[model samples]
Target: MSQPKARRSQLISTYGIGGLFPSSTTSYMIAGLHEWKEDRAEPLSEPRLARSLKVVALKQPPAGGRKDVPVIRFPYTQVCPSCRRIGRLHELSKDWNIAECSKDKQPLNPFRLILACRRGHIDEFPYFQWLHRGQGKAGSDHLMKLEARGRTSSLADLVLTCTCGVENRNLDGAIGPLADFGTCRGSRPWLGPETEACEEIPRVLQRGASNVWYPAVRSSISIPPYSEALSKFVDRHWPLLADREVVTPALLARVAELSDGKYSVDQIVAELDRRRGEEQEEDDLSEARLRSGEYSALIEGRDEEDIDADFVCLPRDVPADFDRLITDVRKVTRLREVRALYGFSRLEGAGGSESNLCPLAPTHTNWLPAIQVIGEGIFMAFDRDELARWADKSFAKDRARMLKVAADRNAEEYGHAPKHIDIVEVAIHTLAHVIIDQLSLDAGYPAAALRERLYVDDNMAGLLIYTASSDSAGSLGGVAAMAETDRLGNALAEGLVRLSWCSSDPVCIESKGAGSDALNLAACHACVLVPETSCEKSNSFLDRALLFGTRDGGNESEGIFSHFVASAVGA
Candidate 1:
């Protein structure tokens, strides 16, 4: 009792979610940060206090304008569970360059939009941007369609706030989901916690409540000297456009000071002017400063420090070393500590070409087992059937009682309740993985044979049991895999690791398949990316992921790439 309770307790506390559980052992999820402060709240923005007003979206605040921190309407609460929708509302820097989307030149990572809540009706539609990264039009008016709808019932949208009381007008971009809390008369085990299910999400959001939210990396490159310099120039010149009025020589001096004599005031001003002029035309803002006296001060290229290459964007007179320093600094700290934990950085390849920034792999935690069963491919085919029979009402009753206590204690008035779907999913995957490894070991399958027969054989299957399905929410499946839910898989992988290093059976990665995971050389770990591939796209979500096969889009299928196959030939 203590061990199981302790494990669940560990999960809840790790997330700092007191409002989610019926007791310490009942694991519940959280949304915002751990606390809320009044200062972070906006003064009830009047972005829509009009009978008729035109709105526009921006990748960043217009050049030289005041800090109009651009906002995207990514739903932290996934309005639609399965698909390749882009409306996760994540942020894109204002400086990223790409050919316009309208020209059929793909905007990197462009996603479609789904599900819009207007009044009580949910008008779900898919929206795609037809422009370049920073060179496209924003659908501000598009979101207004939702706001125009009447208010919702108790469980509906209202004020949205961060744990720090920083009111995020739209949902934070796509949050990796952890578990589901379905509607119910009471709580259940799988969803973890039960407290405060009655409370409306938006209301709790306004006060900065937590729900399965993971901090994500927000700023990707494009900071430092150029951003700082332009910030100053915009402040001094574009008073109305700046986030704060009164950008002065002091701000410009700060930017220059940091540049180490690599950038000049003149260069900074010109870059801002060039970019600003183009964007302002869309919003119809005047860019008279280009020809006004403001342009006079930037005539000479005065000395500024070196700009770091990692932050290199529309480069100014900044030097090469500046970029190096930024690269070093990024590895240690998150750019936007609250919103994101990592960024997409370019690393130099052996060929010396830039490679995409790789996301760090997730690790297993206390409840997570080190291994899982093997030989469970056939079992997955029975998932829809097996789950139906495994819904134990007796266990659910205990789970519900525990959950109700949580709701009462947390003071929640509205929200979805816990569901048993996850429990069955977890149980089956865990059982399958365990059985596979055990069966293989008992049959005296050598480590090499185990790899071939259990891991790679088409008829032979294994589960990345702890991992989330392609459509899973809240840090996706990484959270579960880290929890060590599958025992058999963990054990088998361990046995293989020992034998392979001894040179008995070389445990290279799988390469011949379509839906597989890739092994990281440096970390010596196999990682799976979901909904990122085409094969992993489910039958129900086929149209949603819009997966193109090797013939159509590119990859095998759409969904999480659980079956990792490396690029180099012959394992």
Candidate 2:
């Protein structure tokens, strides 16, 4: 069969291993990492990412190679469009060459519904079991058919029938908790011929449901020291030094000699030491630590003579009009972001339990799939002292407590970890959304293409609005250009103005809570919410009321930027 093409980045984000994609003929799931031909894939060096994921190395997905990613046909049951007869694809077809109706020769369509469990096991729907309902034994001889009575486009109109004279069943009760699809067989088809014993009940889902596949991706921005030439050179040659029992002066001298005097022996030795120190500093790296490194780099800025370094930032003056609210601005003219996929889960959100996450390969693999995107961005730091005072306000605490209550309830209901809600984080996050919405219009990038990175904690108050693309070597400076005093001031002003009044006003702003699980307050699609891809927290914990205070009858509570907005309006 001819293989379909996918972008190298998509293999990690959209269609990584075990992910299902549709071809012209049928749908197929990407095979496990064990099936991938490593030679066709290029090696990617991202030590921080490897350490965070606890993997030895990373590799870019193969594209335009002699061999491509392997795939296995999914939802093996194929239904004849003409006769409505349903059976396994292998049984319906005479051989691998043909996949059409055996009797009518009509093209076959894959059964839309499949079974999955919280544990990430998936299997074809138990058709024989459902058709027989345990009344009698079912076998290959008993032909089954799926008939859709075109009366209404509902599952109730869809019927599954068997030739054994058992009572037919409709698909009405086949999808939810009441589903009798039976226990999961723990099938790991992507890894090939693997099935385990599972006791969890399987839920029926459409083949293309969003919850069917959620790739747990971890990303880090290449910053300072790490982005420098000498550091990168060490990263490339570390495997050589790493294999040795010890890095002696002789080995260091040889490595420096191989550089042909481009780097001094002292510089190489220092870079290697730094790398080793970072590895030894922590056994498990956290996301906060990764962002902390990037935050420091952006704040200090970097102007390298090499010009080809992965990261280059130039500090810019804060817009005069918004200087009180904004502290610093950095124009990141060049940046590289590395994203690696560690594992994936089915029927769960990105924060599912580690035990439930399916393996990328049949066994432990040292390398993971990753991709790097180069781009530019505008990083703006808020006045931390001012933010701290604002977060201490009674109204800010109340609003934050409300959102925290919602988040805690959501966590309890969903069985996920409770979210840590900081009033400063909420305001900064909402500000990031409003600014991203404005930057989308001014920066020449769609909201989806633009992404936000929030730096809000006890010590840091900032956000980075950046656009990265794997297809381009670097960005066109649209985002970074907006960091200029005049453009950025206008963008911030316009963003504040836009947030002052949502189109869904009163109802939207007055609401105690809104959005998924009521985890948001005074925020919705009509106002602060951006594309899922653009947001870090899935558009949760946002409250425009926190940015521009809310009024209830005679009482008004001031927000973080309420004074700025009031002064701008000459109130």
Candidate 3:
């Protein structure tokens, strides 16, 4: 059999360890990280990302050469399309080259349904139990067969039967809350013969369901100093400087000399101290802390562009039309972003309990799978004073409170931490989406290829809209070119105008709560919602009413951007 192939980047973003993918022959699941051969894969160095994940290093997914990332057959059960005889792959296959039914000599297809739990365990559906309803015991000689009535495409039309004189049953109620597929055995097939005791009830799911796998990826942008030549050199020799007992002034001086005097001993010492300080503050290193560094580097632009540097930023004048609402603009000509896969979750979003997270490796490993993409972006910082005043408005407060109530309810129902919904965050997030939608038309990239990063907090209100891909198209500079004063001003004005009315209006404009978990108001696909990949919050916490005034029952409420829109239209 020919080994299947996948891009190294896909391993981290879409199909990491334990993810399922279909090949020409059959479906397979990526093996656990332990099966990956170290020599076939190369190591990657991203200090901030490594520290955030609490790992010593990162590695690319194994590719090329003789051996690559390993995979294992999934759904063990295969059904003969002709005779409807069901059995394990080994039983049906005459040999490795042929997987034909033993009785009818027909090609076998993998069972469409599998069992999974919220705790990330997966197993083959218990056909025997479903056939007899746990009333009959199956012997080695017993055989099970699946028969479809061909009446409809629903599970109620599919029936499972056993050779024993036991009653058969349909597959109805196997996918919903009424399902009695039984408790999970905690099977971790990707990790070999390992099983843990679990009480989570397994739910029946199609092999290709989107909710089957959700990679918990954490990414960081390479910013100034960190993306500088000095930083790269220091990272290359990190092990030597990391050891305090072996380090000395002589070693520092020798390292400085090796740099051809491009860097001084004092500079190396400062960088080392900075890394040590980061290690000491590891506990305080949250997502906000990570973005804070990027925010500062972006707002305080660097003009000296080193051709070889991974990141380069130049401050641009804010468009005069938007100057009152926008504080600053930075055109990111060159940028590198590193994304690492820490873990994954099944049957839900990645924000659930730690116990629900599936390990990438069977045992502790010092490294994680990661990929880096180079891209260009445009960063815009909003006026803090103006935003603060808007957030204080009674209507904005009421809207925020309504979203918070919905978020609280969603958190309680989904078993995840509640999101802190603030008016400023929502308005900024919505603005990012609206602009991204507009940029997709003017910018060269499609909406899915573009991405948004929000920097919102007590002291920060900004967003970076960039297209980062593992391919060369990521650096086309189309996005950054839009940062030009006139272009950006026109884009902003057009975006607000487009969002002022939605195709799903009055329902859309009057929507008090909409979207998943009712976390949005006056926002839908026709207006502000963008692709899930483009949004940081999964398209949540958005309200066009907050950007443009709402009219409910003849009472008008002015929005934060209503004045700007009015001024642009000469209203």
Candidate 4:
């Protein structure tokens, strides 16, 4: 299995880190790092791969007795170009640089095609079986070969011939809506011998095609630090301190012994007392847990003196136009973020299936493979009263109704509804994009590098747009600098002005359900939509009309930010 070297950020965002991808010759699968339980003699001393996102690589010994670690292998079947015979290549021949047909001595080619279904199942192309599908002896042993009739590279020009000497099939009709490929075998080769029932017809795809795999990834921002200092200490040392029994008298004795004089029993007991109301688990990424922490962090404003702390929040005076609309503005000078890849979908958008992000597997693992990024950002805390007042307006309700209907229809078609994010959240999210774009120009960071973490729920209305990356040279401070009073005010004014009209305006602002899943109403590439990585919602639920007026012949009502724009212009 071969994979392209990608940046740590790209691995988290574009091609999933612990997900499956393909290359021309093989289907590459990345397994969770937590699953690598091999002994590490010098773990911290292990050198990181420069330029590549791969954190760990263990070599598999040539010979094995109950292999310590699972070896990654992609099975290959060979096709005889001369005799047109196809069959699985023996396991030993996997390392061969060149393979020849057993019967004809002709050079063989690695089978370049595979079968996959919308359910994310993938299997080797059924070359022999496909050519003889209708025949009674289709399952009988027969030599299969791939032959090209013409000098062209098109699928129509390629043909599959069998040694049964009677039938041959063209590669044509292997794709498209009416493709005749057989039902999906529901093979999850990446998971090793995993199979499931899939009724969807398989589609023939050349190895490494974009449609082969789509990863579903989830991420969360660490709000201050969700755990108490003692809880965090226990979590960091859980592997050593954890036991089958609860923290009983005997278990406490064992924990003290395991601590090796690092912490006394009295100290540990005190910490446990402090942990009573905290999350019991070491690694808790529950949706409710994450959202609640973030909500509290946003609503309960951080003190100005804590600006030098782990999660710095320095308040900025609101611009005159935004004084009534926004209640607080803070510069997040330091923050930590964790992104994890759990499962994936195929042939369909990952956002459509809400279940993919849920516990797809039967049981939960203690840990999920994660990448940590430390960065600087700006947070905008919206005035809840003002937000509600705007949302209750007749036009705002009408717009929300239209968006809700479209979203519901999309959800019904896709089998699950996207978690409810209100129109106000959409407004904040869209503005986040606008400012991110403007900051890209003024602050010198690429637009794709900036990320938005929306803090919106029943209790909180705010967002933090930050520069997040796993790179060593983190937090360039450009983003935090822009959060200063004068700079942030100017950035907001410019961002709104830019969102007022787009290069594709009128069409962009007026379109109903126009972007990636027909999710956007008035947003388009030229305006609010940012890189997929930058957006928390996959760039959905955005409407420029909510920020600036729907000025392109649609609802002509001024937006929530119109006061800021008007005030800026007047100034």
**Full-model lDDT, candidate 2:** 0.84
- Local distance difference test values of all predictions, in order: 0.23, 0.84, 0.84, 0.64
**Which candidate, 1 or 4, has the higher TM-score?**
4
**Candidates 3 and 4, the one with greater TM-score:** 3
Model 2 residue pairs with clashes:
none
* Per-residue lDDT of model 4, residues 1-571, tens digit only: 2233444444444545324444443334544333344342111110111001122321211112232223243435666667666677652244353355566766556676777666767677766656777774644556556788877888888888765665778888666432565467777655556677878777777765666656665555555433223344454444444443555777677767776776778877776554333424424435655656665675554554433334566667877656787788877777766565556676666766745332223344433344557798888888877888888887678678878878887777756764564878888888888988999899988888898888777667888888887664358999989878888887888888767879997788777777766778888887888888688787888988887677644545558876666666667
**Cα deviation in Å at residue 546, candidate 1?**
14
- Off-target runs (Cα >4 Å) in candidate 2 are 96-98, 134-141, 151-153, 178-181, 244-261, 264-266, 471-474, 553-557
TM-score of each: 0.22, 0.93, 0.92, 0.79
Judge candidate 2 at residue 212 and give its lDDT.
88
Residue 378 in model 2: lDDT:
94
Q: After superposing candidate 1 on the true structure, give the runs of residues whose Cα lies further than 4 Å from its correct spot.
A: 1-245, 248-262, 278-307, 311-571
| Residue 149 lDDT, candidate 1, scale 0-100 | 19
What is the Å distance of residue 322 in model 3 from its true position?
1.8
Model 4 — TM-score against the truth?
Answer: 0.79
Candidate 1 lDDT for residue 445: 33
> Which digits, one per residue and each the tens of the lDDT, describe model 1 over residues 381-464?
222332333334343233234333443432232222322223333222323333333434433332122211011121212222
Q: Quick one: RMSD of model 3?
A: 2.7
